[model samples]
Target: MPRRGNRLLVVGLVGAAALTSAMAVAALATGAEPVAAGVVCPNPVDELPAIPAGARIQVERELSALDQQVAEANERLVSTAGQGGPNFAQNAILGPLRDKRAATLERIAIAIGREADRPEGLEQFATCALLGEGEQPAPTTTTTARETTSTTAAPEQEQDDVAARIACPDPTGALPAVPQAARAEVERELANLDRQVEEANERLVSTRGQGGPNFVDNAILGPLESKRAAALDRIEIAIGRVSDQRPGGLESFAECSLG
Candidate 1:
């Protein structure tokens, strides 16, 4: 009988060990945090703090304000295409909007007793959605490009005017906006001429030992100088007549066409 009892005890011990290992594997597979033996895992929702009164409303309000800010910045960008480039607009406008949105998310997380260390772009407000149940949803309409011509062209023309107005310095201290198409053409020409000038300079440097002084002067420098002058003339014309005043302290764009 003693021998029989010893065998039963050994069997029970092994079974218990196998059960513990299985539990651990299951916990890991389901991403549940491991708990000490005999301890119960706490429910995640139970860990959240009780919702405070008006918390949801306040969060919604802040979100609305942030949305307005983003919208305004977008409008400004559309109105002014040459507003110091895309980086400038992002830094000056979008960055702040995103930060505010993140802060609102953090605030909501804290109110609901959740960890605020969530990854960006995945912010959630569980209770906030309830606050909008009585409100009507905003209507949305989709319009194809062909149908949007009348509406889109005006904004584009306005953007072009803004670009031209700021592209060149005003001679009489009065800036004027121009057509967007014209601005694009002018900028393109300026860029092309700028490349040509660079190529000419490179050619002049390469011709140093290949020819005599007169040959270098006539074949390379003379033609290059002429092209540079022509580019400058085109740039000036694109800049419009206002630049003829030289303005208060506007630097000469003519230098860009020079070697």
Candidate 2:
């Protein structure tokens, strides 16, 4: 009888140990924090905040409406380009459309907790470049012989002027540490700006001497220069806002490339 009682007690001890080991394994598998020796395993799902009622439906509706507006804007941009009026496509159509679309995208980012601002999603939905329409052609301008002579400059001098005008700011120490909440949207916008800079560079190279002597200056360089400047400015503002929120914020974002 004494031996049987001892055997039962040993078996009970083994069973308790096995149960504890199983609980620890389960916690680690589910990404839960390490449990203290005497603490019970926490429910990981309990850590997450509850989704607000109707939030998903509201976000979907807003996204759908924004997409419609973007489609209409693309149509208008193409139509204005086809009309062949100087500055009409850019100033009246594309500019306003880009502004509205960007604003809508920002709102969506804030609403859906920044996941919607990812590059893949923005490239698919927010970018106007994917609309399958060509850029407006530069309007023909008649130049007198004197005008041509006065306008033409040495290749080296032209390069120097371009280099001087588009001098990119050193964003190394200047970038603010983006909070986790705003990280997705800010990075998405920066990626978009980087793409624009790349496209501008490509356009500058491709359309160098295509339209006319002034084509490079009027159609390509001027607009691209403006865009690059604006992008850089906005990037600064975004970073600045984040830095203002916390100490050591600027230094924390060492990986960010503002160029």
Candidate 3:
């Protein structure tokens, strides 16, 4: 009976030793921070704080903004694609804008990926619905693209105008009158652009105000983005000139090719 009791004690000790080793392995594997040597095992979940709603919202919003930027950029590329005309300055200006926007997207992706060490975070957010989880039901691809177009079209219009204007409206030429068709197209595009901008602004406001996270990164960062903003301003001025009553020349109707 004493031998049997000793054998039972040995088995229990082995089991305890195994558990200890397993726990040690787990700690090392999961980067389990130790409170102290030979002391209490910390609760893993307690070690990390849940991402705050505000922070998450901000991060998510930034992620979306960057993604929207990328999409808009690609769209610009498409818009400018296959054109082999005198739009040399227009295309030239877009080069740097494209590169910078791409860089911004990369940085944003890196930030999203590092949150609490998540993987596929960049892609996740890129593919994630703009409104975040649940509120919109199934992930509708068509709706997302349409919404993206509607959201980004305005900023591009404004920025393109701003950029063109900043290039210093050609003092060499006088203000030209817009062609009838071009005028109609410009008006139509501007109206659509305005509607889309309003939609996007509304989305931004609603997203930020939600109990979710607040996206402050894009809250008027600085002039780096102003280059693009300038482009928008230039575009607006140019469009205004096109629609202007002044009779300068036919150059104002150059964009008539857009149609």
Name the best candidate (by lDDT): 2
lDDT scores for all predictions? 0.36, 0.39, 0.32
Q: Candidate 3 on 1-259: residue-level lDDT in tens?
A: 0111111000011122222322443334334443222211111111112223223443444434443443454445456555676654245434444454445445544543465443232322222111111222332333344345545567766464333211112322442444664565545544543443344344334322211111211221111122223333444555566566543342232210100
Tens-digit per-residue lDDT, 1-259, candidate 2: 0111111000011122222433443434335555432211111111112112223344434445554554565456555555766666557655665566566555544554643322224322333322122222121121133235335867885565455322233343454566766566567756765676566566555433223333333333333434544455555556556666532332222212212
* Weakest 10 consecutive residues of candidate 2 by summed lDDT: 5-14
| Residue pairs in candidate 1 whose N, alpha carbon or C atoms collide under 3 angstroms | none
RMSD, every candidate, angstroms: 33.2, 30.1, 28.1
- Native-referenced Cα lDDT, model 1: 0.36
Task: Give the winner by TM-score.
Answer: 2
In model 1, which regions exceed 4 Å deviation?
Answer: 1-181, 241-259
Write down the TM-score of every candidate.
0.24, 0.29, 0.22
Pitting candidate 2 against candidate 3, the one with the higher TM-score is 2
Candidate 2 colliding pairs, count: 1
lDDT of the structure predicted as candidate 2:
0.39
User: Which residue window of length 10 is worst by lDDT in model 1?
Assistant: 5-14
Off by over 4 Å in 3: 1-176, 210-259
